[model samples]
Target: MKMTPHENTKQFPALAPGPPRMFAPQTSTAVSRPKKNSTACLACKAAKRKCSGPDAPCKACRSTNTECHFDPSRDLRRKVAVKRTIQELTNHKDLLESLLSTLGSADQLQFDKVMDLIRKKAPFQDIAHAVGSPATTFGDPQELSNASKLAILEYGENHIETSGNGVRRPSDPGNIASSPEEIPNMKPPQWPTVSPYARVTLESLCDIPLFEVPAKPWTKVTDDDYLVSHLVSLYFTWDHPCTQFLDQRIFLQHMKLGDRRSEFCTPLLVNSLLSMASTYSDSPDVFSTPENVFSRGQNFFHEAQKLWEVEDDDHDLPNIQALLLMCCVFKCQGRVKKSWMMLSQAVRLAQDIGLFDTPAVSKKKMLPEMERVRTITAWGVFNMSSQMSIELQKIAPLEYPTSDVKLCGNEDFDWTPYPRSNKITYDKKPARLPEVREGLAELTRTLVDVQNLVSEKRRGTNLDELWRKAQDPFDRLTAWLQRWPSVPEIQPNPVPQVLLLRIKCLQAIIHLFEILNDPHQPQSVRQARFYQVKSVEETAQCLRIHRQSYGLKHIPSQIVDAIQTGLRILVPQLEESDESRQAFAELCRFGTALSHRFMQTADVIHEIRKNALHLGVRLPPEVIAIFDDPEQWRSLEP
Candidate 1:
């Protein structure tokens, strides 16, 4: 090192001289360290040392020869857990709030008990029971909306108490149930007078009251449970099968039990049904003043209206059922405008209750009974609304439900016949009512399609456009016919009620074919003629079944309408074909026989007679004899 300057100067000078004096870019003395890592290993962080990355071994850990590990979500897990805890607490708080709000009107003792149970962390069922909502099981808020505590309390408080199966007892036994002064306030009759025999029949048959009726002001006009029961039996035997709305088993069971609190039974519903049933009864109490035939069931109608008036906040299944019955009552009373209005109201209310949206209910599980009620009521609304619309010559207000809600289970068998009535028998067992309803519903949907096509044609849609639109419904009709089961030439002992539904389908087919073969349009004459012939043949089969199964009086009023419509449609062929003439005669006989029962039928018969006279076709002697002989009609009365 001491001689470096001179000795190194000579060697350096020799090297510089060889390559011309470049100092090789002055290399630095400092060394670069491994890049620092933001996400460091546990060991590296503890040691306050930088890490290169999250590789198998970081720079600091590798130098120290220590194990390294990292928690990827350590920071986030704590915050997430805190948030979930907050949400759970919030839900519990909401539940308490809703419970308190629902039970605001409860007595202090019960409310305090509920509050204490909540404080002591008791089960929701115990708390709900403490608050007098035995049906309540705390779940989602939507469950509360279905049956509120207030509704149950109001229903229990306002309705008259039922003592047993015999008679309904009033809440205040000391109070006089009837008022003599109220009779003066009653309105006069609106329609034509009744025959004197109408009032005398019931009075002559049973002078003494058979059984006690409900001790209510509305029901005082006819205080006989035996008569009421008979009327109810008649309704179930005839009208119930056609509408098939109520759960007969459950309803009759509750009715027999006199359980007013039961959801399936309500005073309004019972009275409304009685009002509808009166049309088939000969009871004098059914008449408003023992003289007005058109005022039949007026007392029960008023009772139903009064009960409905008191039902302010509640809109449960019974309300809808009662409203439907009320609509029918109005139609029977010849108040078409009111019936239409009531039907519209029912449809709106049904939608509001989410009965129409069955799919939405699946997410929030409903009780079996409630779900069944909703499904059947949905179908009822659809059927009734569709029929009313068809009658009024308007489009259907509701579409068919698309949800997979099912019919009642098979365990809900045919209802037991009313105990005192001998109308229903094993040998004359009709088709299952549900099957007939389903068939009618499907047929009504097809009819709706035909109606829409007819409406389009009325709007003057071009022929090609109309034909193109018609294909889907036409094909559907054909497929429906293909799917229809064949009827035996001789229906077993008593013809099933399902024959009527088949006849209705045939009528629909005929109507659709008529539309397709409209004279103004290019006609599919051969196809139309084939269906027309088929319809007549099917109708004849139906007539044969009816003749074999039961008397003309037992045939449904709907069948009478069908027969008249068919006759009117075939009037042109009457002069040419012997078969047509025979059908015309037979249909007239049927129309005249039923005409005594229905006012519209009488009017229809008169119009049909006028049309026949215009066509120079004379009425059959048998049909004329039916109109001339009062004894014939009197015997036909039920």
Candidate 2:
């Protein structure tokens, strides 16, 4: 019998006793799949042999004496393929999460181990095989995980909804769970309602991440604890919330109760309260009456003073300065007696601290506060004098009658002499009229004294002080203008304008006399006096022009009323005069040309305030003209 294929193989000595296994002839498919050759260094593309490109002097090239240049394109292609494999592996979020969960459960998780696991599970057979067999795999699992998280986070942010629809589906499936809509809207778990400790913790969390805090079904953090406490303080201290809940009194009380004793207390909050009180004092409706606000403001000032007495050295000094400013603001709104008392205290404090005697401690710091104080002082004086003038008019009808005495050619302008029986003899002693004249005279004298002191001190101080003193004369003169009519004329014949002019002339004359009398004064000082004389002459010319333009028949009781009726009507006609307009245009051009020269002089004066250079270079004639005619000043563009 013919031997069977297995039986024949078994019968042969080589086959032994084992059953014969049929062997197929080797084909292309029968051999194992050829592995990509990663070990073939990129430098040896044409050779089809291993190379040592990375190591210096590639062995093959050295042997052949050929230059061994790295084939960067080949290396780049390999690197790209490796990166593509890794990116695909990292993009599989479900696989990564599953692996993470498994490792977490085993308690054997490590970055390297996870990375190894990822390489084993990566989609590319090359990657899997390479990991198992060693030569061609790439990537780190930690790096891949980080990349995945970053991608998901970006997708979630970009897709968050503006409309009612919560979120759009993520373009990448790996980001599905990170969707805003998919995350459960679980309220932060509620703790007991009355627990302060829990509330503090919740508030801290809310403050740290304000945007993340939810607005939904009642959570442990009620808006009251999280929002109200902090916001109430901020709204009260800063200018926000846009609501007028508390007046000055109630607001101060609430702030004090909150134990909020920061710099926010005085200058920020209390000073704002003082400003409100002042505004309300002027208004009829808001706060109804400022009495309560004023009282509360005074208390706030005292409180701030106490705080300042013991404040830390490092705290802002400007805040304390602001407090003093508020005190001045409140005091100005008070009665004359009260204002006087407050001003006396303020001046004493200012002087004691050498605020006024020396250059301001820090000009940038203190100038605004000083200006505020000066403003309050000026306003108080104006109001007081105005009230006094009104009272005097009411009391002495013969002297300060509301109706004009008609000093024209009418019977009212009677030149009758007093009867000898009624006329008290001036030979032995003149009869004293009353306290009214004495009081007014004393007040006027005091004002003049103060004016002189300011003028004297101004010559030795800074530009700011000089400017302050310049304003003082104007203020005093204005007050005197209001009171001048009350005084009986010293001259036998007085033109109403002439009488007013005389008072101004006297003031100017006095100022001029003082400047001239000082023999040791510098030439610059003499030049300054010349400009000042020119200013006085211009003011006199304005008064004369005013009187002539009005063509008034008699002396009017109110100087302002007379000037208003006279000057305003004349202005348009005066402006229309070709000669006047030409003169004004020339003055404006001259002022524009000379601004640089004046600025230089101002800078020089600013530098040497109390020496030969203290007085600025004489003001130009055109600048002087502009001050005399404000309409001309307004016409010019800066």
Q: Which candidate is the best by TM-score?
A: 1
Judge candidate 2 against the unseen true structure and give its global Cα lDDT, from 0 to 1.
0.34
lDDT of 2 by residue, 1-638 (tens): 98775785453356556678898787553447855544444446677877765554578878888766664333423445345544455334323333444344422423354467466764432222211211122345665555446554544454322234643443545544553456688443243322111223332333321112121111112333333233233322221111111222233333445433432233343433333232211121122112121122343344445554665534232343343344334433323344344334434443333334332344444354344333323222322333232222211111121111121111111111111112232122111112222233333433443445444554665533544555655465456545554223423332333344333333343343333333355664555444444333333334433233222211122222222222222223233444333333332333322221122221222222222123333333553464334234223321
What shift in Å separates residue 152 of candidate 2 from its native position after superposition?
Answer: 79
lDDT of 1 by residue, 1-638 (tens): 37754574453335443656756776655657976455667787788777676775877778889998874433222334334333433434434544654457434654575678879997664443343221222334443333234334544454343466734444764342254465566453243433343544333444332223342322444666677766777677657776767877677766766766767777888888888877666566676534223345778888888998897535378888889999987765435778888888888777767777532443467788776777777777887787666556666547665333355444324433222222334343543666666666677777777788778877988766866887887788667766665567337543335667677677777766666675644456666766776686667667766654454544454575477677676666665676766776667666666554444455466567668789887666765676455346445421
Q: 281, model 2: CA deviation in Å?
A: 8.1
Model 1 TM-score, all chains together: 0.60
Clashes of each: 0, 0
Q: Which candidate number would show the highest lDDT if scored against the true structure?
A: 1
Per-prediction TM-score to the true structure, in the order listed: 0.60, 0.19
Model 2 quality (TM-score): 0.19
Q: Which ten residues in a row have the lowest lDDT in candidate 2?
A: 408-417
State the displacement of the C-alpha of residue 438, model 2, in Å, after optimal TM-score superposition: 38
Worst 10 residues of 1 by lDDT: 128-137
Task: Estimate every model's Cα lDDT from 0 to 1.
Answer: 0.62, 0.34
